[model samples]
Every structure is written in C-alpha cells, then in structure tokens.
Target: MTPHILVIDDDAAQRRSLKTAIEALGHAVHVADSDQAGLEVFRRHRNEIEAVLVDLSAPERAGNGFLRALGDLHASVPVIVQTSEGATHHAVEAMRAGAFDFLVKPCSIERIAAAIDSALKFTRSGSQGKPVRRARTGTVGFGDIVAASAAMGRAVELGRRAAQSVIPVMLEGEAGVGKEMMARAIHATSERSARPFVTVNCAVIPHSLIEGVLFGQDSPAGSGEVPGKFSEAEGGTLFIEEVSELPAHVQTRLLSVVQGGEIEPAAGKRPRKVNVRLILATNKDLIEEVKASRFREDLYYRLNVFPITIAALRRRKEDIPHLARAFVERFSSEQRLAKPLVIDASALALLTGYDWPGNTRQLENAVFRAVVLADGPVLGERDFPQVMAHMASVRASGDTAGARSAVEVGHAAAAAVQETIVHAPNPAPTVESPAPTRAAASGDLSANVIISTDEAGNVRKLAEIEEELIRFALKFYRGQMSQVARKLGIGRSTLYRKLKDYGIDPDDPQKHAA
Candidate 1:
C-alpha cells in the first residue's frame, strides 16, 4: 500500500505546495480545506490515509477534534499538527489530545517526511484507534486538564482529591486558567454528579442584584420571581466565580448559607434549607481580602477548606504546548471548518517566549483570532499582530541589553547641549526668539524648551526645532557628531532618525540658520 498523507490547510497555495513537496518525497497526498471536510475524507479513506497534516493556527479553532476523530477511527494513524511561527500555544494540547507530532509551517520537506515516517511507526497503547474517548466525563480533568509540568501536576492532583468531599472548594489563580472547568470536574467526580451544576460569575452581576441572584429572589424589583443559584443547584454543585466581587451584604448572606446550610429568599421570604455544595473560585486572594476586611473571615475559612490554586501560564510555560493544543481543539470544534489550522514554529516559539500577562484566557482569545482570520491553515507571527508586536518590542529592547545605556547617552548629550546654551554664551540672541532658550528640566531634556516659534505664536514642529538644535550643537561642538547627539539627550540611532526626518546633514556641521 502506498503511504498516503492527508494535508489539511485553508490556503490553496500551501495545500498545493505541500502536496507537491510530499509527493516529491515519494508518498501520495490528499488535501482538505476544513475540519468537516477533512474528517469526512479521513473516514472515507480511513485505512488508506497514513498520516494527517493539520494547521492549528486558527485562533478560532484547532484541528485536534478532527485529529482525535481520525485517531479514534485509526489509532495507529498519526496526525501531525503544523503551525506557523509564534503559535506554540497548541503544541502541547495537540500532543495531549493525541497528536503524533508537531511541526512548524514552511518546514523542510525532509523534516515533514521524517515526522510522517515516525508517525507511521506509531501504535496505540490505549483501548481503541480513535473513537473520541470521552475524558472520563468532560473536558476538565484526567486527560482534559493536560498537565505536564510539576506545578500543574500538583494543582491537578489537588483538584482530583478535592472532588471526594462535598466541602466548599475554592480555586485560586489568575483568571482564564480554567477555575470553572476544575469546579465542573470536581462535580462530575463527586456524589453530586447526578445533580445540577450551576455557575455564577459574581463580578458580572449587578451589585444590587447579586444577593437575590445567589439566594433565591421572591418577586424582587425588576427581576420578577426567580430562584437563586442556591435553589437552582439544590442537591448539586454551585460554583461561584469571582466570589470576592460579591458585595458586603451578599458576603454576609453567603456566610449564612455556608454556616447554617440554608438560604434566605429576598423580601423576607422564609429561610430555606438547602443541600447545595459550594465550589468557589476567585482570582483575588481570599486571605488578603479577609485581612483587609473585604471578605468575611469565617466565609473564607469555609470556602478555603479545599483550596486548589491553578498555576498561572507564565509560571508553567512547560504546559503551554498542551494548553495551546487543547485550546486549538476546543476553539476549532466551536467553529465550522474543513480543516484544522496549524501554528508555525515561529509562532510556537513566540507563544512559548511570551509572558502571557492575560494568562490562558488571553492565549485562547489570541488563538481564536488566529484561527478565524488565518488565510492558510498556518498561524504565524502575523496571525497575532498585537501580541507579536509587543513581543517584538520587548525583544528589540532585550536584544541590545543596554537600551538604557543608549537612552542615558542621549540624555547626557542633550544635557551638555543644554549647558552650552544656558550657561555657554547665549549665541548673540537671535531675532526670532531669545537665543532659542528655556529652563532645563529632567526626564525630557529637549521637551518644553523653546527653540523657534512662528510669528503667529504657533509652536513650530518639534522635529524642525530639534533639527535646528542639532545643527546649532554641531557647530557649537565643532563638527563633533557624537557630541551633538549627546547634547540632544537621545540615542545615536534616535538622533540619526530625527536628523533624517528633519533633513539635517550630519556630515556638514556648520549648516545652521534654524
């Protein structure tokens, strides 16, 4: 049987290029543009399909579902996720979700062939080939959480243990690290798995209605008659997200519920006995809040009985590969696509290197955008423009390792020029102004100082006056370009850019006449 590979990418050119390249490597290639289409093709030719090359760059999607589907159909069949530069967020997710390998876009033919060759050698140790093995219950724990790092492993271990008891479990971490998901997983594994599970994000609810929303409202104003989250989750789990955002009164109300194991309805309704278990999640520190008197100390103790702190993305970048892959599959399944998008190597490196101030949720949003707008199945550095731009800026500054030195140099130069102008000799007092002078200040040597103003009192553009200052400094410093740049309080490169912008000739220093 001729080894056939299925290439799933939205870009026609990329599909054609890969097909031609893979075929040249002595294997056949089948191409699909979307996840739905790819899955159909993979199922139809399940046995004939040797490997799958998927693009997981769509910020809005991932190819993992298709890959997972294909895996179930043919567990031995390997799925190679191809991503563009700056998109490694999905690499681990792909691997954890059962992908054979990960590759970056525009990778060499030899590399692709090598990965495919390895993938073909794969044999599943699991039960079946690719029947979407349900994650015990849902996408939360077990294989769902996708932990590889010790930090995450410990956090997940705690979460699993917290499921055994009906005690209130409080999850602490930066938002978007899947606190709610953990709550659900705990609910699924507990005795309350058959009961209802309700989630209430306290931060989003109106301050006035929070109590009523959480503790059954009895014909409350404007809200009509509504059961509180407590009643809704009776005999089940109630996950309160952003729990600290609840107002002081709500906190008191919640305290009663936790302490007395009952809830009081709005407008003086009878306090009702409730059997709802609490699963609270907060990005804020409950201990700190308790100390600050913002959160009740007693309530904090009750909820903190089973605390599981989900690690932030930055602290656990090792898990980025799995998290990224999981999100790719997660976001991709939500969209209607013919093929799974791939994140390029550069993208993966970018993601891995990023600080992710926004955590996993931020990564998910970026991936969603990449998936939705990516032209090809490839998500490269260009897919996440804003994030890549920040990363690039940080890289530029870090690369020099002494950008501060350059800035300091510019400031020193500008200070010298200021000294010459303010204390040198006043340059005969020009007719346009008073020798283009002003009081010296810190932080910005050139800013707020008068150089040349039009007769109409309109302030001349800073660049023009800056050019004049540069020319004046050059002549004053005797054609020393370095001196002029220093007196200007800006880096040499910045001075050069400014010089070019203002049409200043650094070679000819005597050219004044500002």
Candidate 2:
C-alpha cells in the first residue's frame, strides 16, 4: 500500500529533496516550506496524508507550536520531526507535545522511508495480519511486564510459584518497576483467574477514610451503602499499592480481614465475610518501617509470607537494548509505522549508560521521545536529549580522569629525567642538545604539540596546525574555556598564555563562528 506523507521544511531545497526521495519509494508526497504552509497542506489533505514530517529547525514558527497544530489537526495522524544533530532535548520536548517520530538531518532516503513504514505499522496494529494470542486465566500473567532481564525473569518465576498458593503476597520495589503488573499476573495464574482483580492505591486514599474504602461503609438511614475494595474483590484479588502508606489503624483493620476472611463495615450492623485473596505492593523498606514503629509488625509478617522484590533498571542494564527495541516496536505498531524501527549502536549505548532514576517508566518516555522526533528509520544518540546530555556529562568526566592520569605519568617521567641527570658519570657540565624534533606518535601526545619553525617557510604550516587544534579544542569544549583547558591538559591561565603566544584571541569572532 502506498503511504501518503507530508514534508515540512523552511529550506525549499531540503523540502524538494525529501519529497522526491519519499515519492521514489512508491509513496505519495506533499511539500510545504513554512509552518503555516505546512498546516494549510495538512488541513487540505487531512484524510489523504497518513503522516507528517516536520523540520525541527524551521524558522518563523517554533517546533512546539507546529506540534501543537498537528495535535489539533489529525490528532491520530503520525507527525515525524526532523531535528538538528545534537538537539535531543528539543526532540524530547516535541515528543511530550505529541510528535510521532523525528529524524536527524543529513539522513539517507532509505532511513526516512523506513521511519515512515514503522510509524504506519504502529498505527495499524491488529488491523492487518497481526497475530492473536489466547488469553491466560486467574492471576494476571507475566505478559504485561515486558522484561528480558535475569533479575526480572527470577521475579516472574517467583511470582508464578507464589500463584500456586493462596497466601497473601507482598511485592517490594521502587516505583514504576511494574509491581502491580506482576501482582495481576500472579492473580491471573492462580485459581481466581476469572475473577475481577481490584487495585487500590493506599497513598491516594485519605487515612481517615481508608477503613471505609477497604471494608465498605453502611449508608445512613434510608440511604444506599457502597461496597469497599474487599467486597468488590470478593472471590478475586485485592492488590493494594503503596501498602506502607496505610495508617496504623487501617493496617490493623486490614490484618483482621486477611486473617479472618471477613471485615466489619463502617456503621455496620454485622460483619461481612469475603473470600478474596490479597496482594500488597510498596516501594518502601517495610523492615525499616517496622523497626521505626511506623508499620504494624503483624501486618508485615502477614503480607511478607510470600515476598518478591522487583529489580531496578540499573541492576539490569543489559535489558535496556531489549526494552528499547520493544518500546520502538510498540510505538511503531501504534502509530501504524513500519517494523523493526532499528536503533543504531551509538544510540543504544547512550540509553544503556543512563542512570534511569525512573526505571521502566523513564525508559518508556525516552523511547516515545525518540520515536516522535526521529525523521529516519533508526534512532540515534541525538533522539533522546536528556539521556544524551547525561551521557555527554559522563563522557566528559571520563575524559577528565584520563587527562589526570596522563599528567601523573608526565610528572613521573620528569622526575625520572631529573634522576638521570644527577646520576650521570664524568659530569663535566656537558650541554645536551634538545630532544629531536620528530612527529609525535598519534595517540600518546597530550594536547601539547611541538612546532619547529626555522627562519623561513614553516610559519604557514605552524599557523595552520595551531588553528586546527584550537578549532578541535573549541568543538570538544562546546565553546567553553574551562572544558577546553581540561581537554588540553593545561590550566586556564596557561591556556590563555598559549592563546596569546599563538597570536589567537580567546574570544575571536571567527573562532566561535561555528
């Protein structure tokens, strides 16, 4: 099937080039040279255009504003962004504002076509030749967790085993680790697979009203009463999240219900019996809470009867590549884009090194950002701005460490030179010539370069080499002096001295032009 695409760029040359490239792939293409013209084209062919490709650097209109316009237009039609080389943060923001995918500039035609295909596949999931799976019964199955890590695998194994028993299970982990998903999986695998799985966020419920919410409350005279989570979950599973946030009184009440298989309703005339199984989750350390006397020891023991601790993302860095691929596939399928939205190795490396303080949730956001901003088939390091920035900082820090090591080695070599001079025999104050002016080995030289200019012609070559190094240093430092000094292995003052000696101005307009 021919996929219709709209290409938006302020550069007429780029717009024409992209339109021709996309059309060459047997797809229909529409072109616009400005954001306003892009919107007009989108509105005119709203139904015909399956996707929109927007330039991130388009002038006279902010990318965010264009994204908002697209959102307001075909809300469901995919909008792919074309971003500059290093503007990942802008890409992420565009994703948050609803871009479908983004591509970096100077991308190949094949890559652009692939991105369009992936986006189309994402939007057309289950509509054409998609596979169907038989739904599993009782507790929720391990299907929703989407993990490929050994740590997560072990946790799922434990959960499956725990499902065989009717005991109350407690899941401990940081937020966004998919604890609730695991809880449902256990329920689906257990005897109560057909029963409803009710979930309640303990932290969201007020302490004063938690008892009524969990155990039901009777109506006033002549009024109807409502059932609480326990009654709603009868013959099923009650999954309580943020369990550690439950007040002491609520904890005691919950304990009685778990132990007795019954609960007394608020304003109750009689105690009601329930046959629901219980699953509790918390991101807190219950042991510490118990020690601090903030949580009930008895309640902890009751829920801790079957404990499963979910692993954090950092501990499972190896799973990132898989997760990233999965996310790409998911978003691609949802947006009706094409398949196998490949991520280049550099992009994958950036994702793997991220600290991921938000775990799976953060990873999802990053993937979504990449998909929305990517203009090509493959996602690269520039697709996720925050992640790329963090990775850059980490690399810069590593570079500094390498420089320090080099300086230490240089200092030790100088000390050895002093020792050699002192130990020389028949020291008649012989004057030694300076070291030969040979080209330094490629890798070993620090930022320092030896320039030998005789009375003539060497001046031009020396000037050229100095200009190149300065440009390299400036690019490496992103035009920051402190960073340039660190990369050059010179103190800030010494860098200034060299800059003057080389007849270069630290703040020259030509130097910072790029």
Candidate 3:
C-alpha cells in the first residue's frame, strides 16, 4: 500500500507546493488550506494517512489546538510540525505537545524526506504497542557514520574499541557534534546489541526530578512503581546526555551504580543489582567542571574510562564535502526524483569553505534545504541562499578572511574536472593533469621565481626561500588567507601557523608589495 501524507497549511501556494513535493516522494498527499478543513480530511481518511505534516503558523489553529485535535482523532499517526523561522518558540511548544518533529519554513526537500522516513519508521517500530525508545534505537552502526577526516576517524576508532567492553565511555565535543550518534553506534556494535538502549537528557530534566528519573521512583504508600532510565536499559546500554548537568545527589547515586552494578531507588530500599553498559556525553570540559565544583571528580573518573573526543566541524573541514554529498544523495533519493540531483562544484566549494559551527548536523540541514528547494537537476550557489547570504554579509562587514576564503574555494572549484554524480553506476573515473603549485598558479610568482641564492651566489637557507614565497603569495592574494592557503595546498590552520612562524603579518601585505 502507498503511504499517505496529510499536509495542512493556510497558504494556498505553500499547500500546493508541499503536496507536489510529497507526491513526488511516491506518497499520496491530502492537502488542507486551513486547520478545520485539515481535521476533516484526516478524519475522512484517518486510517489511510500514515503521517501528518501541518503548519503551526495557521491563523485558525490557535496554539497547538490543531495538533491536539489530530491526536484526538487518531493518536498513532505521527504529526510533523512546520512553522516559519520566527515561530521557533511555538515549534518548541508543539514538540512538547507531542509533535513527531518540527521543521522551520524554507526547509529543504531532503529535510522533509528524512523527517517523513524517520516518522514512518518510528510508527512501524512502535506499532506493536511497544514504546519506541529514542536512544537512536539500534539503527546506526559505525558504517553508517561518515568519518572522512583523520580527526573524526580517530574518534570513531576509539568508539569501536570502547564497544568491545562494558566500560563506561564518555564522549566529549561541542554541541551538535553527533555524540549521541556515536553512542548509538557503540551500542549497536556491542555485545548487548539485542538489548534495549535508553537515553536521558540531563539538561532538560528538572533538577528536583532528575534523581527519580534516573534511579526510578518508588510508588507512594508502596503501591505501583515508575521505572527510571537505568531500569529501562537493563542488560543493555544507558546513554546519559549532558552528564555534567546532573545534580550532585544523582551523581553520587550514579557513581554507586558504576562501582557496584546496582541502584538504590530510595533511601531505605535495598540496592537492586542490574547489568547495563553506560555511555555519558558532555559539551563542557569535565575536568573544569570538577574544578568549579559543578561535577563530581570520582564519578567523572568512572565515566571517563574510555573518553572519545569528536572534533568540531571546522577542525575537520575535509569531511564537509563528503557529508554534504551524502545528504544530497539521501535527500534526493527520498524525494524520489526520476534522475538523481548532483551538487555543482561551486556549491560544494561554498559548503566546504564555510565554518559550520553547528558541526555535521548543521551541514546536513543546509544540504537538506538546498536539495528540497532545488529546481533544476543540479544544485548551484543560488540553491543555497542562506550560505551565499552569509558570505555576502561577511564581505559587506569588511571581514575579508571568510568571504575571501569562500570566494577562493569557488574559484578553485570552477577549475575542477570531476563532476561525477553520486550513485551513478559504471561511471568512468577521469584523471587530470597535476594541479599547479601556488607559485606556478599565481600570475606574479609564475612570471619570476624567488632567488634561492644570496648576493655572493651561495645558496640561502630553505626557510628563507619558503618565507619569501609565502610573503609573495600573501601580497599577491591581497591578504586573503583562504586563497593563499588553498593555492599553497595547505589547510587554513597550517597556513596561520606558518604565518606566525615567519612573523608575516597577513593584514600587512604591503611589506612585500613589490
């Protein structure tokens, strides 16, 4: 049977656009221009509809009432909330009110495709009345993760080793760096692969209730019982997010669980023995947290037994193109396009050049937006309006560093010979001429080589010639670090290091103006 999607929005054009996109994904779509009409459509075809994609900004909906109304009709079907960028607060509220997922407007088709697929999967997994656990739930393996760079590869390799044992592993990285995904991969590959994997976000839980949430609460008057996260992951893996935010009391109890493999639910209750692997994550420096008296030192030691630090997106820029291309293919396939879309070299360069502070997640979202709104068979610079807009803004603000880097990348990509579309079979690999070095490529450097010998015809030190070339390139590129670095075949970080080593002021290129 074909999966059905119900789209509700007040704007007629948006409703039509969404319906077309959803139908292109091989799903039957039902559209409603208003909340009341949408409810009628859902009620009429309730069982047929597999998922609902509704806009939360509808004037008639009146504060998540539409979502509740849809739930009232049929609670099993997933509801994906959509809203304009400004309505982020409302979107968060809708999530709290049981939204399967929330998307900001102008979102890419790929984002929509991924969300719909996940929602349907969630529905199917929980169809048997078993509650679906969001601990990424035995889906992701190490192979599923994209680790093209050595930095990320190291982190993944460490995770693989940690999976061999029940050692409490700690993942340290900036927010949105895929720590949860790493944890899930560890669990999926571990000996307890068949058991449950439960997750608890310590940051969001109320401080007072965190203890009961992690350790399970005793029934009042000794009646029934509420199982905490620890109990839920018996013989499996328990992933605690933002472990640094855990209250001191909870930390003490958690330490006991780690040390003795048992948990005491209440003050007077006897310790209940349990077997489970632990994975904790934090965005802050655990040692600093301990120094500040915010986290426990002993508990930290136990969790940090097998620490894996995932590098930030900026530090691993080499992986951006790979991750972006993967997203493009995934999202394009999900949209069910007759022909797969390919990202233009310029588009790939623009993506690779930008520093994704939000890490791989942000890059994925960017690609999703680009793939969704793309009109032609190829995604170009115009397709990524947000990225181009940011570069434009940077240029306008006189921040030559970032804007020039992106421009340089675009220029380099313009000369790239490869244009292979992903998933294309029997594609012949093309080999090209070796790329010219920075000195050869630069007009000034190509015209004349720097003198390697001193006035007396004696050969100068290697550092002298290298520094002269760098200085010449810096001046030639007019202090554009990205262009200089790329033309020289080095990373931006390495370029900066060399600049500092040579005491070359990047901003003062006039020193070598000749």
RMSD of each: 21.1, 21.4, 18.0
How do the residues 152-233 of candidate 3 rate in per-residue lDDT, one tens digit apiece? Answer: 6557778889999998999988888899999999999999989999999999999999998888887777886788888899
Best by TM-score: 3
Put down candidate 2 lDDT per residue, 360-380, tens digits, no spaces: 888998898888778988787
Clashes of each: 61, 45, 2
Task: Give the RMSD in angstroms, all C-alphas superposed, for model 3.
Answer: 18.0
User: Which tens-of-lDDT digit does each residue in 1-514 have in candidate 1?
Assistant: 6788898887777778778878877888889999888888877887788788888755567566875676566455767776532344465456546565665433445446656775565433211222222343443545466554434555666777888888889898888887887888888878888899999999999999888788766563775667888889999999999999989988887888788887766556677899998888888767667767898888787778887767667545545645665566555555655555555545665566566768888988888888878787667778889877875686576854322211111122222222333332222111011111232233446553555778898889876676667765654443434456677787654665566567765433334423
> What's the CA RMSD of model 1 in angstroms?
21.1
- Estimated TM-score for each candidate: 0.53, 0.51, 0.54
Candidate 1 accuracy as lDDT = 0.65
lDDT for 93 in candidate 1 is 55
lDDT of the structure predicted as candidate 2: 0.66
